[model samples]
Target: MKKILVVGLFLIFACGSESKAQAPDAVKKTFQAKYPGENDPDWHQDDHGYFEAHFKIDGIKYRADFNADGSWVETETSIKKKDLPKAIKDVIKDKYGSEDISEIEKVDSASKGVFYDVEFKQKGKNKDVEFKADGTIIG
Candidate 1:
């Protein structure tokens, strides 16, 4: 009886872990079709009820967010600060001269053009700023 109980418990734990590691079928299929990459991706459900795909293609890391129904939302990818448009970089540097930029991400959206979101720490507080393609601050 003890042997059987141990085996059952092991199986239950294994099954739970396996299922948690898999993304839902619809979300997985949509990501595979859109990404069209050779590598498998991981899926996560965000607090906003959106499915997000975290993967890499051609060696560049990316996270693509999708709705529950498999509709594409946006992709967030890290980018070098120098890769940003000169005007945008200049504005950021000039405005936040004291703060150091920790990270920059390129946000690609279906409905809007690409934008850069920069994360910085200022006076012990963390802040993020969004800039449009033309160097204008949107948020």
Candidate 2:
């Protein structure tokens, strides 16, 4: 009787570990299809227990949020080369006089007005500058 109980307990523990080790295959498949070209993206559980895909496309990174059951909720893409505003370009060139500003992005905030965010590396220290649509520094 003791041996039988031990075997049963072992089986239960093993099954639990297996379940924890495996994510829902259906969820992974759906996520891959939804976020077409994301390479080796990481899936993280959000507050609502949904999975989010953090991936890059066309050299621009993005975060695709999906529901717990594998349904897509929303996607946020970082500022891409083709999406930068002209006002931001002038400001970055002038402010960071000697630095090479690699990328500039115009981020549309839901609450605040549109802003220009610039990314540059100065003396090996990465810096991000946020400016208003009119080229005024906001951050």
The TM-score that candidate 1 achieves is 0.77
Per-model C-alpha lDDT, please? 0.81, 0.65
Leading candidate by TM-score: 1
Top-lDDT structure, candidate number: 1
Expressed as tens digits, the lDDT of each residue in 5-100 for candidate 1 is 999999887664223335567767777788776356776677676777788877899988788777888989999988999988889879987788
Residue pairs with backbone atoms closer than 3 Å in model 1 (clashes):
none
Model 2 C-alpha lDDT per residue in residues 61-106, reported as the tens digit of each score = 7665566666666665566644556666577667776776666655
TM-score of every model? 0.77, 0.44
Candidate 2 C-alpha error for residue 135, in Å? 1.2
